[model samples]
Target: MTDQSDKLFTARLADLVSLCERDGTYEFSSFLDERQCADAEQWCKTNTGSLRYRLWGGYENARRRMLAVYPDYCEEYVEGDYPFVCLTFTYRREDKLTHRDFLGTFMGMQLRREVIGDIVVGEGIAQAFVTEVAAKLITTTVSKIGRVGVKITDSKAFELEDAQKFMDISGTVASLRLDCTVGLAAHLSREKAAVLIRSEKVDVNHHTVSSVSHELKEGDVLSVRGCGRFILSGINGSTKKGRIHINLRKYI
Candidate 1:
């Protein structure tokens, strides 16, 4: 997120903070992916002095979230005033659709990706979160997803559980270094993990981290491109032999 290499995006984030400060009112943005959210958080750390901010995704545990920048006086109004709406799509149970289908269809319409949030797909129901401006366009236009007819409704109270699944990965590593933890999370050798880090295949906390010896703290999120995503959930006590015991949640 703080990668000086990506200066353009960082500059845009700076402008958002400045806008919020100058207006002394609530300023929100389109839905942001995990990587973008991380960037926003990093950029705001040193930049936003007195402004308060949050990244809400319209629903709980949302993979995509929107940024809310507001002053202390407007703190109570920010939560209810997020500009995103949730749209529920009801379809035939036999259609056997997927989240990818809904997402691809939305993008095919030329809707900006940042305007879309989480798409919760189910047997006969799917929910998509989007900005209010984008919601008007989708509700008025979208009726089918790739030949499968569907009904779309604005259901603000209707909520669906996100279907992300994960596996438990617990083991002891020589240390909490990025390389050591990546090896355990991805079932790769320590040397191989180091190689992947150097090749820019491992990202810690949504930012590409190439240092093998980078210290990984508890609750750090790691994404190993080909392997998958993982969270360093816990760091238990070390064994008598000095190896560190850790708990990882590997997203399946």
Candidate 2:
């Protein structure tokens, strides 16, 4: 059932992309706002499988665009406003990027407003609606303030607790890395890291990594699919390229 839905969404997305490329009838260049969503929804209801329209952008910009397209839709959104909304604005950098690239770039894009959680990667690359994108963006944004895992060599259990408290960890483990720095840091055994790898909990280069010994290189994205992602800065110790050091930011 999931597979069928995925395929359907992909097919629909392809059709939309084709429409954008062929006739520009959907006005891909224009920002889609709340009003646009309402208008689009009405049109979709009547047209059935007609290009599924959605708006994506930062909140205010998206709102403005939507209002311009469908003022009444904005009223509905305003009346029942939730803290989160799914909408994205297409930018010049995103114009030629693929869905995967879009996700990675979105993860790295700057947010000028306060969104309280790390953005989850959009579940469906093909049929990604504004909400899904917003969710991911929010999750990623939250990660900045989140805690990352670090191992301090020779640190006692009590010290570890102190470290965790110092970090102010909450529910989820926001980031993970094999800390090679020489200071009071949390450390994960190769065995534990391997378990994460075997469980399909780790991703490198935007793909799931199953090998625990997957050598951490400089500038690699150590993304633990569902867990979080960290940018691996170069090893900071004694070596030609320095020690194997990883830099992590919490994925919200």
Candidate 3:
């Protein structure tokens, strides 16, 4: 995220937290991308004290989510409390729609990006998580995504088939430094990974980190420009050679 945009988002998020505290009610934010979600979570953990919050995108492990800030005494969340709905778009298999196609069509509707969450495209259908405000209007008036005719219906679940899949990768690195893991994840030499880091081609948890020495932990997501995205899935014990054993899940 850009510096200016980051500050503005943080400022707005601060307001949401305060509103929940003062009103003793849940306050919801518009959809947040992965980067924004990470930042918002960090902010809450750092500043919110005892107040509780939820970052959910309609389903477990959702890539896009909304910020739901609630009072600490509030125990759990129910479907009725959330402001999002999952919409399914089914079309002919021959239509061959892309993620960009679905998102572009929504943009054509003059909808802001924040109201739309994850748009998971599958073989013959796409399940999109959108705010209740957008879902009502979209399902009623929109009949086609681009030129392909689609049947739109409200769904309680977003199909897992459209969610990201990963290829298991296990390796040992000298250290959990950014360069070490980047090289392992991207299949580049350590030197090449260092170069890539300095050249501004690596992002950890959606934020660019240029330092090759940046320490990484399990569950950190790394995105390389040419290489696919990856997750540091596990950190097992060290090998006989003293290299740290690690498991990576690369997005397929």
Candidate 4:
């Protein structure tokens, strides 16, 4: 039974990849309606493969339906009244080519603010997906990605407040300026920055540097391990003693 299931799953993945490549894109988002989910879940049950299809749509609609049907599947909710959702599925394959192809297609489409929830493939798939996404997102030869401080087990952990903090340090930063006052001004309040840096979650130039107070100079690339990376341009000037102004470039 297990062997048959595995064979079916592999074949399906191959079909999916072929469909994507032939069309230059594949979109399952539009096909997710209440009725479609019922059909899919029912179809998945009789199937032996580890791979299964699921639906995502308006938050309440998708959640209510998914939980009622696949109660054993892990779920987490994001706050807000909006119906936005990110649907996903899991496939067990020792190889990573399929996962990379799937992610690459979505990223290639460049949908703005498109949320691709963490894909929980096997360890090998997870590693490959990260590498593929990183390479695709980089524009310049030296692009910086920031970190999210917290390791999220579920999607609900991704909060708006946490996102705002990450932007303050890395997102909205324009440049990494140098100069005494510039450095001081660039210095973000340790308390606010510490939430991320203290966790030893933030990385500078690919090395984990937890010190929020760590002075950054021009041409320094700050990488927040999980969130993303930033390039330090240079400090604009000093607002006052012990306070310098700096800027950082956003990569993602």
Candidate 5:
């Protein structure tokens, strides 16, 4: 079932690319979740050259992004000029709005999920990236999110900084199993890590891997639901106890 889904997704993306090639025009896809983005990137590796595609979500650090495919001649197009519009939502200074809050509110608006990209929560404000049409619709229709009244406006001038947070960690694992690597990166017991994997709370490269014994390799990204996200940097060497020494960069 998973392979079929992946093939379908690849086909859909290829269709979009074909459209761009046929018309000699830039083509943009709807917002893709993390898994979809990873899949699309993998597809690009063997199928299309990097210059033919780009990804953007109105910011340098975005979990969800849209794929833009165009002819090789259109390489000069700036990513910022993509069809995404940033909407800034402001509420009372004392009111606390989280990423989840903003996302839930937008989802409540009954808009298509693909039309929404990323929602970034900042101090007393939150920014959302959506299709141009969704931005215009949201400004007029969205007035409140739960009890907090919100004022929405275009944030075209808002400057996004590179604010991705990560911490480097080093540890030794008995093996390269998913549970072992997750335990080391999250500082949890092996039993707990196995439980998380069994309960479907672990993802590798954005795809859920429920097997605790799944082997992990270098450059793999692991996301534990409650723990956090981490990248398997590399296996340095083996410890005296035969455990593998590894490095991980955990995203805060």
Candidate 6:
């Protein structure tokens, strides 16, 4: 099923590239999940011409991003002009919400995951990016998330902010193995780290990899469920005991 999805995704991207070349105009794709976005980027590098594309999710920094493909002539297009809608969800102050709550509400609508982009949870409010077509459905049907009444509206003047906060930590690992790196960044024992990886609770570059021995390199982003996310910023050098010195930035 995954392979089939990748093939269809690649074909769709190729079609979009062809459309841009043929019409010499801008073409946008439906909101893509993290895996699809990565595939699209790789496809663009080897298959298309100097076709410029922009990845955005109605925010300055987004996790799930969509692609906007255009010719050089369309360089003047702004990020806000992308074919997406930002919906602001407001609930009662007494109802404390979370990212999971907003996402659960959205999923309850039975909308495809591809139709939604990044979801930012704020104090007493949340912002969601969905395909322009899905915006109406969400605003009309999404009234509650587990008893919390939500009022949804189009956020025309919404300002995007950095959705994540980070703290820097430096440590030395015995090796660049996935478990070792995770143990260092998350401050866990080697046994606990291996359990996390083996349980499919870890992701590298947003894709789940269950191999405890998966090699990690610089710039790799690790997302550990319940432990937050981290970026392997650098491998400074080797320690005297043959361990690897590394710098990690943990998202708070």
Clashing pairs in 6: none
lDDT of 3: 0.88
Q: Count clashing residue pairs in model 5.
A: 0
> Which portions of model 2 show Cα errors greater than 4 Å?
1-6, 25-186, 213-217, 225-228, 240-243
What is every candidate's alpha-carbon RMSD to the true fold? 2.3, 18.8, 2.3, 20.2, 3.1, 3.1
TM-score of each model, paired residue for residue: 0.89, 0.34, 0.88, 0.28, 0.82, 0.82
Q: Give candidate 6's error at residue 74 in angstroms.
A: 1.1
For residues 1-252, could you state the per-residue lDDT of candidate 6 as single tens digits?
288887888889889899999999888888877767777788888887798987777666677888888888787974757878889888877788878887877787788888888887766777888888889888777788778888888945555465556799998999999999999877899889999999999999878889999999999999999998899999998988999999999977
Best of the two (3, 6) by lDDT: 3
Candidate 3 TM-score, true structure as reference: 0.88
Per-residue error at 216 for model 5, in Å? 3.8
Candidate 5, residue 143: how far the Cα is off, in Å: 2.7
TM-score of structure candidate 6? 0.82
Q: Which candidate number has the best TM-score?
A: 1
lDDT accuracy of residue 225 in candidate 3: 86
The list of candidate 4 runs beyond 4 A from truth reads: 1-189, 240-242
Compute the lDDT for candidate 1.
0.87
lDDT computed for candidate 2: 0.37
For 1-252, candidate 2 gives per-residue lDDT tens digits of: 256854664455455556644663342223332333444445445443433344434332222222111223233444223233433322333233244453454446653222312222221211122333455654445322112221111111111111111121111122233222101022454555566677877656545556644555555655554445455543444434433333443433
Per-residue lDDT, model 6, residue 180, is 97
**In lDDT terms, which candidate is top?**
3
Compared with the true structure, model 1 gives a TM-score of 0.89
Query: What value does the lDDT take at residue 184 in candidate 3?
Result: 94
Model 6 has how many clashing residue pairs? 0
For model 5, the local distance difference test gives 0.84
- Winner on TM-score (1 vs 4): 1
Candidate 1 per-residue C-alpha lDDT over 79-160 given as tens digits, one digit per residue, 9 for 90 to 100: 8899888899998999988888998999998989988999988778888888898889889999899899999888656467
Candidate 3 lDDT over residue span 1-252, tens digit each = 678988899999999989988998888989998988899999989877778888888777788888888886674653458888889999999899988999998899999999999888888888998888899889989998889999999954666544566799999999999999999999999999999999999999999899999999989999988998999999999988899999999987
